[model samples]
Target: MVRFVDVPRMRHWVEERGVETVIRGIAERIESDFRRWPEFDTQARVASHSPGGVVELMPVSDSRRYSFKFVNGHPGNPAAGLQTVTAFGVLADVASGYPVLWSEMTILTALRTAATSALIARTLARPDSQVMALIGTGSQAEFQALAFRALLGIDSVRIWDTDPRAMDTFERNMRPLGFSVHRASDGAEACDGADIVTTCTADKAYATVLTDDMVRPGMHVNAIGGDCPGKTELEAAILHRADVFVEYPEQTRIEGEIQQLPEDFPVTELWRVLRGEEPGRTSAEQITVFDSVGFAIEDYSALCYLDSDLGEGEAADVDLIAEPADPKDLFALVAAGANSTVRLG
Candidate 1:
């Protein structure tokens, strides 16, 4: 029996434990795994792009466990009364290659993404930073707001979105959580006097959500929207000005904001920073950017954490794998189930 946590069960688990607690736990796990970054086999996700959106398979493994996620991104999904992104994942035993856990990763992805942003910002953002300029108040807006507040002690957020309804929703949702939510008329206005600028728009084309002129000195940019080829939030000029950090350079050059720059443009891997091999925020005046293209190892960590947490709970179980009574006589097992004792070997 494989443990399965569908959407409803996952929601219940999160609600019972609280979002902040769950996110913080996941963040701790992610940071812990990142410290041992050299142990895992990592690679860029395999993506299938269409005119509407992209479907991706992100996989990672260590010596003990293998994990993968199937996810999709479609900006037009909201208009069709669907989510912009949805995902599911599996965790399996490496030796037997049998699934040990199955889970709905749509909510998990949001949680992990927000946790990752906060984890990175803790290193890249200034120590005194409290104000955040959150552009694009969509599905991920509230999650980012909460993570930053919980992890970085941010007390205020100035948010902006092209869709007024979405901005209103973000404000309504975040204010109850004790955040000073401010609505801005434009992206530039949202970024004013802010220490961290997070762009999380859902668009399939290159967008100038944050221009170079709007950015100030000594600011940290959490760029999470430009996760696929040809989909970006910040302008090319901003990339030229900021010192960028990424998950994997080869993958980020193909899918992240760095895709807009020359092939040889310099960027640092974030794990190196976590391992103290590279500097994160060198000085007070230097601008830092975490060009976030969600990596597979992050999902690996999340799955591992969930598997441990859900193991003791009364989570539902599904018979995902068939068991043969005799290892070598698989057909005999099927024949027995059909009430026929056939002698066929």
Candidate 2:
């Protein structure tokens, strides 16, 4: 039997452990895995795109375990009373080639994405940064806010969204949690006087949610949206002015904000900075951009973290693998069922 965490159980786990605690744990796991960047197999995610949105499979593995997440992003689904993104993932034992855990990843993805953003920001953002300008206050706003607070001591958030209801939802959800939420009239207003700027809009087109004029020196931009071939948020000028860091250069060139630039444009992979081989923030007045496209290894770390904290009582067991009583007698199980039916007849 394989351990399973369905949507309800996953929600329960987060509620019981507290969201910030879970995000902190996942962030630590992500940092640990990134520090050993050479130990895992990493690659760009396999994507199937349509006019609506895209579906992707992100896979990564170390010598001991393998993990993959099947996720979809459909911007129009919200109008149809569905989530814009949903996902499921599996962790397998490499030696046995059998799955050991299966989990719902929609919530976990949100958690890990926030964790990764905060983790990189902690390294790249200015040390005394406090206020964050959140450009898109959709599904990811609250998690981003919480992660930044947990990691960077940021409690004040200036938020803006094209949809008024989204901004309202974000304010309603965050204010009671001891957050100082300020609704901004536009993206520039949101970004004004903020130390860290996070853009997470969901449009699948070449929409410039953040313009060049909005960004300033001494700020870190966590661009978590615009994660596909043609989707982009920041102006190309922003990339030109800021020093960009990415999870994987190969994948970022295809699917991140850097896609707006030339193929030969320079970028630094984040793992190198984490390993201390390269510098993160050389000066307090320099602009930094984390061109996050949601890499596979982040998911692997999140899955491993969840698996480690799992308890038998809270999780269900699923009979996903068929094991024969004898290794050479694969047909015996089926034959036994047939014989029992014949006897009854």
Candidate 3:
């Protein structure tokens, strides 16, 4: 039977390990995978865009296991009484494609995103960096805030967003954590004197949320939200003057900050830094950018965590789909569908 874990149970599992621990574990998995990165089957992703936003499916596996996630991003969803994003995923046996687990991925997605941010900050951000400027204050804001505060020693935060209600939502969710959260009126005010700047806006355009005039040396940017083709958050000028890092090259070139740059522009993959094959910061004054496009391997890392840590929870016995028991008995499953299986009479 496939075990299903809900968000409440997922939250329990996540809280038990804590942010820093989860991030470190993810880093270890990423490093291990990257050491032999060629071993696994990889695909960029498939996306469906509607009037609201976008929906995506990312699938990958080694020879042993398979997993895929169904996630949708609808910027106009909240107004329609739905989460901007809703997701679910499955873990399956690659040998037969039999699903081993079915799990809710909405909360897990948030956790994974936060863990990825923390991992990047640990690898690329300064040691003493404590303050962060969060550009978007929507569903992802609180998760990013909590992850940074827990992992990167970032105790103070300055937040800004186009949505006042989102800022309010962010503040309300994080106030109990006792971090010094400040709401800034504009992007410049939020970034003033901040060590790290995170751009997580939902706009799917090439809007320059952070300009050269607002940027200063020694700043590390966690550029989220600009994961699609037409979406970008940073000014093009910043890329010329900054050292940019990414998770995966082929995918991020079309998704991350380098999407604005030429085909041959220089960028560093985070794994190289983890493996000591590349330099992180050559100078203390050099601005750094982690152009985050939310890679699937990070999701793989997250699913690994959930599998090990998520204890017993509510499970629904749902027959999502099935095949015949016999390897060559494809006709039997359909013939047996809604018919007698056992002979008791």
TM-score of each: 0.96, 0.97, 0.89
Clashes per candidate (backbone, < 3 Å): 0, 0, 0
Clashes of 3: 0
Winning model by lDDT = 2
TM-score of model 2 relative to the true fold? 0.97
Off by over 4 Å in 1: 336-345
Q: What lDDT would candidate 1 get against the real structure?
A: 0.91
Residue lDDT tens for model 2, 1-345: 999999999999999999999999999999999999999988899999988889999999999999999999999999999999999999999998899999999999999999999999999999999999999999999999999999998999999999999999999999999999989999999999999999999998898999999999999999999899989999999999999999999999999999989999999989999999988999999999999999999999999999999876778999998889897888876885664445552
Candidate 2 residue 308 Cα shift, in angstroms, is: 0.5
Candidate 3 structure quality by residue, lDDT tens digits, 1-345 = 677777776666657877556655665665576555557787787888877688899888888778888898876788789997889888888898788777899987887787788777877787778899999998888888877876776878899998899899888878888878999999999999899999998877888899888889989889988888888999989989999998887888887778998988999978778778899877778889999998777777677666766555535556666656886877876774655668667
lDDT of 2 at 145: 99
Positional deviation of residue 86's Cα in model 1 after best superposition, in angstroms: 0.1
Candidate 1: worst-modelled 10 consecutive residues by lDDT: 332-341
- Model 1 lDDT at residue 279: 90
What global local distance difference test value does model 2 have? 0.95
